[model samples]
Target: MGRARCWRHRSPRRWKQFHEGCVPCQAVGVASHDGYKRGDDTVMVDGGVGDSDESGLRSIDLATLSGVLRVCDVELLLLDGNGPRAAFASRVHEEALFCSISCGFHCRGRFMLPPDWAMLGYLHATDETLSWCHGVPLTPGMALTVMPEGISEFTLSPGTHMTLMLVPVARVQRKLTELSLRSTPPAGQALSLFNLASETTPLAQHYQQLHVQLGQGASLQPEETEKLLHEHVQALLGAGAADRPGCSRARRTHYLIAQRAENFMRLNLRRNIYMNEICDAAGVSERGLRYAFEDLFGTSPNRYLSMLRLCAACRSLSMADSSRRSVKAIALSCGLWDLSRFADNYRKVFGELPRDTLMRAPAQIGQPA
Candidate 1:
């Protein structure tokens, strides 16, 4: 493949024109022959295969896949050898931004959002037990999540598909005011998971339909998009008012312990990590730490750490300029000093030698590959 190019919106008028002209739908249709079926019943078109400007779907590499809504420090660690293939489709409207994402591998990642924006996410398709957010296992009918602002973590199983909308906090507040509803908490509050199984309000049903349409690669006009955003904001406010309970206490505790340990692991990724240090950082006993890791990631702490380092190394190799970097340097940088052992383990997880990844052309950072 040739070097990928970034999509730049030179001006608002031009960007608006591009989206208003049904360009995204056309792009997806044009690439339909190259499309693949995802578990969610959505088809993902590989539009990023070449330098086509009109292509809406873009292949995402781990090194270049930023946050779903905005640019942030996104660290995606692959859980298996599926080798990092994702496709993204996005549309910008007057009131919000709509995104559909399909991943071909099981992976976990974390990202932070800006305070000005709030996100509503729907799991379009995934296995019942494989998708998780903030340590809570997600179910199909459990539908929506009002993502918190500071940081959100998720684990997506292979073939997991999601549809998300990012709207400005000001817009949500305006909708609430128009509807004569009470003001919501700031965007930086804790996440609120809403279940649609027991009671499906009109607004909730509308939001679900819109999410489904977007996931199926259908583009909406500006007015329709605005209406959808309004209904979603109303639904969120209504859900907030309902006396819905949060996650169980045990689950919450496990999430906190795992999150603390994971944060420390990320900070010290370039050096040796000790279990005692992790336990101390998480303020938990060694057994407690082990239980947290197993509950959250389905792996022992040591094994998860090793996978994290290997994933970091894989991303580095994919993005590094091989002309000036060597496999040894990358391995050592990720704290893997045993060259022979590192190579064997890396191949076992990634299905390729580290040097082979480095030799391939790197995708353009911050752009679709």
Candidate 2:
């Protein structure tokens, strides 16, 4: 894969400020690589720079049958399937996890959001679907109702393409207050997932169009994004969570455990810790630990831990003095044992190597001469 060009960021403060303001940032850039085959039918694009934080275009490459992409900062994951199964996820700060996906999968969890974000989306099938929302079959178009929370399992059939936009609750509430209207923004479970594609409503049609644009890796303008959020909130306010207030107590317990575990992970990022330690810290059993992680992260504890540590290492590299410490030393401090693998993963995610980032750090902020 070819190396990506990076802007010289002067300091960690600049990085923080840039990311903090980039709520609707673009995902763009392309790097080709040797294909790695998995099992019998899956192949991964070996090494590639997915996008730069300051890049103007959203991803140049589309995830489809012809090409496979595995980018890190956007947290792209393509699971093994008959063909290359792929999904793209990028968070707009702490407000949301923006997702564009084309895959057939099954998930068992309820979103454990921080009470400030609301999940919204538009989805349709390229072929027939075996998809279900809550307990009912989710068809192409219909009037919607609030779905009960803590669904046991949600399934999607092959050839399902969708766009999920997570809007902060504060944004929705503010929008409603501005219009002199008010409605409860049920945390995505109690609103209309099925009728998002209904042809009868202009709003639904607009959602489909926006979803298609997002699938093509187009960035919505700030105004347009706000409009979409407002539309979703207005629709949701019509149907509050109370309509489907039959969430399982067991699932709620899982969410509580997951939140506690996440808090523990954040506080102890500097220290290398294990799953058992986290379980003890959260006061949850092994099974509850598994359930908590799967519900919140959609992955295992080990994978999530690695991600946290890697991010911590990146922070150090972005702010530390190269004269005082080598990349290997900083990595070891963050519990990363392999230098070669760390550089590769770091470049794939951030579009630059550790040394490259350190070189860009301003002299005034890093170390005492």
Top lDDT model: 1
Which parts of model 2 have CA positions greater than 4 angstroms off? 1-25, 29-201, 213-230, 240-247, 294-299, 314-325, 337-369
Where does candidate 2 have its weakest 10-residue lDDT segment?
A: 62-71
| Candidate 1 wrong stretches, greater than 4 Å | 1-60, 67-70, 85-88, 143-148, 180-190, 198-216, 240-245, 359-369
* TM-score attained by model 1: 0.73
Least accurate stretch of 10 residues (summed lDDT) in model 1? Answer: 1-10
lDDT of 2 by residue, 76-192 (tens): 222111212234323232333344555533322122223334456655553322444443344554323222222122435545666566555567567756654544434433455
RMSD of each: 8.0, 12.6
* Position 359, candidate 2: lDDT: 68
Question: Which candidate number would show the highest TM-score if scored against the true structure?
Answer: 1
- For model 1, residues 1-369, the per-residue Cα lDDT tens digits are 011122221244533443344222212223454333333222334333323233233334454454344323467887666565666655555556676676767788766555456677666567655677776676554545453345567788877766677666677667767775545633334566655544366554665566556555665654755676666655555565333335678878988898789879988988999999999999999999998777777778998889888988878888777767889999988889999999999877656688877776343233222
Which pairs clash inside model 2?
Answer: 27-58, 27-59, 28-58, 146-190
